[model samples]
Target: MRPATVFLLSALIIGSLEAKPNIKNFFSKHFFKDVYGTIDANIKVGDAGKPLILTDLIQQDQIDEAQAAAEVKLDAFLGVKSYAGYLTVDEIYDSNLFFWFFPSQSNFEKDPVILWLQGGPGSPSEYGLFNENGPFFIKDNKLVLRNSSWTTSNSVLYIDQPAGTGFSFTNGGYAENQTKVGEDLYKAIYQFFQLFPNLQPNEFFIAGESYAGKYIPAAAYTILKKNPSDEIKINLKGLAIGNGLTDPKYQVMYADYLIQHGFIDPKSRDALKDFEKQVVESMNNEDWDQASNQIDVELNTINGLTGLSSLYNYLENYSDESDDGIGNLLSREDVRRAIHVGNTDYGDSAVYSYLSSDIPKSVAPLVAELLEHYRILIFNGQLDIMVAYPMTVDYLQNLDFVSAEEYKNAERRKWRYGSDVAGYIKSAGNLTEVLVRNAGHMVPADQPEWALDLINKFTKNNL
Candidate 1:
């Protein structure tokens, strides 16, 4: 209930997120969103023609003078401003990133800002926006207000990154590694701040799920490297990764998880043993492509062994594709025009394929270094089979940080939401790992109330 009073990248380019991040993953789809829509139904905000800007609005006379002399008329939203547009990152490549900015519904000046990145390396942030955490959900092709949107108390910027995800586009070569991805993202972020200097003072954080586990660290490391520069100074703070795929090394506990969850017996576990060895051996051999491929193969094998159990959530018989119906919503001509993407195309398989080779490589070193300074929030759904249990715990318990040992031994305190034991959290120094009960890969979608509370508490250091 407490509003954030504080709140990515700066430079030439910005921002997929994926499912499972093992090559398939999502939500934290928002690594992951932007656009103008309704929150409470009484609002007619952020029409492109009268875009609500973040400048000193109280100075109406000044605004009049600016408007009178303005070359380009802009759109405006009510209360806190909301904007959706494209920011060009690469001139030679003609890469432009699309973004949706929804200001804090509670305290625009105080609440922190968040950049949500959904995983899939290719999953549109729109999946997270409309399907999960953003202010509204698209239902029956209508924008329905989501009361628990994180934007209720904090500004959230959702971007379609790396030019090819969502509405982003580029004629240049696709990014093939974390370094290239970081470069484009940093530039786009720089332009974002350049375009909106008023938000420079707010505390900012980067968050995503699934493959964004890799993207988040890449983005953060690039930002931290640029903090001392004068070109752009983002008031960078913390990070959050939901069911991320940071290190593929310790994350080779697939069959163990399946066995513990009762999805497969020891005999079936034995069947996957050879595949597990291949994954580890491939990773050790530095054949990242093969490693990722083996992991995906292992997962498919598991699915075959255990039919009808969703990879996103074991409790559900159907796989959770957060982007279901999302494309339909975005395909509407009015919707495209509303978001300012004029005749542009949506996402495709290219981004996923572009990142496939980069998938199995470990970003654990970057994560460890990041934990030394910024606070890192690691969370997972109890029912998620994608970035399943033990894998997250395996890496968390082994991180080389100031509080690594303390984190190892720290008591998992019971976390409650309205008298219900919602989850268990273990915290020490800059790292905190939470396991949400009855949830899956897309925590925000499965448990919006808990999702909102998490961002509020984590950003405020109240968790």
Candidate 2:
């Protein structure tokens, strides 16, 4: 029998005789399919934490009723599946950790695990699971299979983390800074590996996008420092970051470059240029709100466009007049559909709301948590102006590295994933930076093939 099955059976046999009648009936009726085998039985506990296992003598009818209620609750969510479950960890102030297991195709043994973190200091992993890199995509307004899902090649764990994002939450007192975020993530990683002792330490890689640039690296650094040597380590492979926010200065600098190169309009160029300067001054003076306001202005201007032609036309053609005009590339409907935002929505509020909402918020803390032990990959889409390629490139160019030449050489090499898209690589110690071409801020949405290829190469050390 499988180890999990064996463990479950032992627990059942030990508790069967003492099990209460109500509890026995409950498991027999409600948890048959949900429980894998004889070893897998649900044991409810009283306030004192005593197991209330079900007995063989319980009527099957009562079990059926209980199981039906559970199925209803589980099916209410988008990605509910057979192996779904929850674990409540009270050691960390009564927080609960929810997980979904995407078992490997055939193997029951310990497999490679990819813990996916979403971007946004506030976005939820559900967006990544359903809308972005998960095994499925929304099509015709329905969820459909994605052939290129990363999980087909590895086990993926989508965590709704921290205390306030997704289903993971605390009644009060959540950590917001890098240090605390890293600590919480470390606890989660430790517990996960502990629960699945068979998972090879070396087969794990940390992956996330956008703001994760900051979170992932910091966490990896912390893990490395704590581990020190390879033998005692988690065998972390590397990290993959998509359209991340690594450095404020570089992002601003590149924004200026993109605008000047015709990727954005002259009016955008003028506005952003002023905004950039103001941001630098604000940063220098430690005036974060002032700097943020400048970005908000630029974002509001971009948000005001109403049609697809207006959106893509501006992207394809750069001019001050073009900024105020609409074209044929994308209609207003197209923009609304692509972003999942509504018509008549303007300003950075939409993007900011998404970022600030419960969805992408956990990412910042998780990234801070994972940085110490794994290699880091910061990937970006070239066409995404909000997190522009030039901005990513600029941020990368400024990282303080141990070997300047190796880093410089890596950056100088032209990045090529396919026939037409162009990119470059920057390697500093274990961290690798990859920029995708002809892609937007959402790399997977714009250039999935290239994004997948880049991930494969980076993880395999082929790039």
Candidate 3:
């Protein structure tokens, strides 16, 4: 984490009628200077310990104008009587750092913090927060609750990071490589810890899906390395990647395997196989465009079959717009809704969203950013052809870890969960790969119970 200079100043009293509070707010008169700059000070209060109070030096006009605009927007976005508060971090370059906090049933002190990362190199974590992975799932224009949210088991923190994605940026001058991303993320985590200083040190684990195969590992490595040697070491437990794209070479090879194994049509198989060879040869010749073109053809073939099912009945309510009768057949509403292209509001939209979102605009070119610092778990749904199990398996196959033998057994073995079948390989202390049965690209979305169980077991033993 980047270090910030701290200054202790005298606390300014607000009013005579109110009690002396540990924290107080003040606005500056400067307009063109930094959006928020703080001079930290030790302030005395009743029983709150000598707390650190950060004074925000912002122009009054700026605060009034921003507050006015926010009030109007909040009236519509929140739809009810609303409360607003602000905190100014001296080190964050952005002037506006806004967030919405909804009341949750779990106690903040008791629950573990679950920081969710959504893969995109450009997409926001909000997609996972409100829909697939977070606490609530919306249905029929109303919020229909979910029983087993990862947040229910842990306190969830959905961050829109790297400066320009979702609600976390200004002017869009974000990091373009994994090193910068890892560094920036460390800053965010450190600041978060300072703000919520009471949180347990070792209860956090980094997690994400899709391109996060890259983002999560990079950030986790940064956190682990930066942790203080004393105290509890911040745990830095383990990482979880769902339907991720960690390595380009393995991804292509896996697509070829899926095709050859009859998971996809013959045309797709042949096209992917031929393209795989071309991509490999192009890489050898350093012809990136040729390799990319071949890969594009393979991907397009897979993308074209978005809603057509290889496992279930094709004519059985194939429309993605509404899940009238599809819920009974599928495990998740997002999966059922994603069965058709028009239901692009949730998971269906993530495919195109990532390809176009801002994170990708900043992070994709920095692929080799954090390879040495983290232990990564790349998981995929066996039924998902987009970022198929073969793709994940292929990526892991090429990783040059010296402890590879320790992470996996000498021979392959089969593991069963209920009615599902998966191949298991463990590398002692480093990695483990187990395919979930009947699961698609979004493993949690397809089989939440199995996903959670796998995660719990993996973290308890590996981290």
Candidate 4:
């Protein structure tokens, strides 16, 4: 269980006497800055009692147990190094963020480093690790090697960020917006590279899904802005977002999506059209709170009638039973101790905290800014209603960037995985978008082989 003080601190920062605080309000941004200044004089160091850095907070980097439990071939672990531990972010409040690193199976020195963040703004990247593209998957009652995992050729780093996320914990106040989340992650990555210097020279990419759409661009922008010199650079190569919610206005194409898919009756579509109109009006008037609430009400109404099937994926039956099992596995005394979680509970708090904040500003501008130098891959599953593929294209088509015309006019090539048609890719210059067929919001899990191929292509700068 989390301490009462943590909630108290969070409330003080986010829940002021003001009703519906605007994200642009000045008070919140500088509240911590004023109190802590640029640096805190009373800050505490790591367990070694040395000056704080990324490596100091590392409690464990053992590959033996996790590899043995994963049942991977001995040769696989020979080149790969897995590190799991808490990296202290706030010494004054004892905020420690947890991370898991899986070096590439190919070449640690040359393989690209992919930093993977999951959606929910709170979902632990471990879900991506185990269920999506991690080195192992839980089967029967043990960890089993996942053959089509993303770690096959590239080094993957998964961190539970914004604090108070799975395995990661914080006694300090939580971040209230995407900007703050980006700053925190920027610091984490800086410390991450500092801890593992060998990865400094390798190609790196920031990739995620859903809410991470907001996170990836914001963090990438922050990294670029902060590190302008080659003396201490991030070697960032590109970015990838899969079924992401980068632009809510464009991403929420439910009315058209539902009507086209026959998920709603004509009468329901009419009602949805009315609600969407009101949402647009509110958004145009800059009443974000009203716009968000109206959209939420509309979504809930649609979901209430959609039956028990997952909103994320219409084709599959949704069951949260796996999350519980994974939680229980991670919460084990031995597991916690091995990962150096100590007494912190493994759960999701970052989601609620982020959602409770004023609606996230659109990440469109951020992505637009990133397109100047870095390659951007935007892939979406055809069946995803939670940030539909059409919505993603709508926003991308509207982006103001250097090669805008080239990207807009590019021919979409047909892509295949084995004998089946995998997806269609439209690429021009640095920006590309792919529509994965028969998949849903979690594309990697739904189409592992295709997802791997797409990622490998993007990382190699071939797409």
Clashes of 2: 42
Candidate 2, residues 1-463, lDDT tens digits: the string is 5444533443343244234312212222111011101111011221222211111111233444322222212221244331222334334555444444454442435445777776555444555665456666656444577766666556777664544554344444354455555566655665555445566553777777766665566556556666574333566777787766656655644345654655555544564455466556656675554444434433433333211122212354322221111111112343223222122112111222323212112233333334333566777776665566666665555545443456667644677655664677766666576766676655765666666677667667777
The per-model lDDT (C-alpha) reads: 0.70, 0.48, 0.46, 0.69
TM-score of each: 0.83, 0.64, 0.62, 0.82
Which candidate do you rate higher for lDDT, 3 or 4? 4
lDDT digits (tens) for residues 143-254 of candidate 1: 6778998999999989877678777777855678988778778776766665556778889999888778888899999988887885569887899999888887876567
- Among the numbered candidates, top TM-score falls to 1
- The C-alpha RMSD in Å for every predicted model, in order, reads 10.9, 19.9, 19.6, 10.2
Ranked by TM-score, the better of candidates 2 and 3 is 2
Q: Rank the candidates by lDDT, best first.
A: 1, 4, 2, 3
Worst 10 residues of 2 by lDDT: 32-41
Better structure of 2 and 4 per lDDT: 4
**Could you say which candidate leads in lDDT?**
1
Instruction: List ranges where model 3 is wrong by over 4 Å.
Output: 1-111, 228-234, 261-271, 281-294, 304-375, 408-427
The residue-level lDDT of candidate 1 at 61 comes to 32
TM-score computed on alpha carbons, candidate 3: 0.62
Better of 1 and 2 by lDDT: 1
Rate residue 317 of model 1 by lDDT.
62
Ranking by TM-score: 1, 4, 2, 3
Task: Answer with 2 or 3, whichever has the higher lDDT.
Answer: 2
Model 4: residue 387 alpha-carbon error in angstroms: 1.1
Over 4 Å off, model 4:
1-80, 229-231, 358-360
Worst 10 residues of 3 by lDDT: 2-11
Model 2 quality (TM-score): 0.64
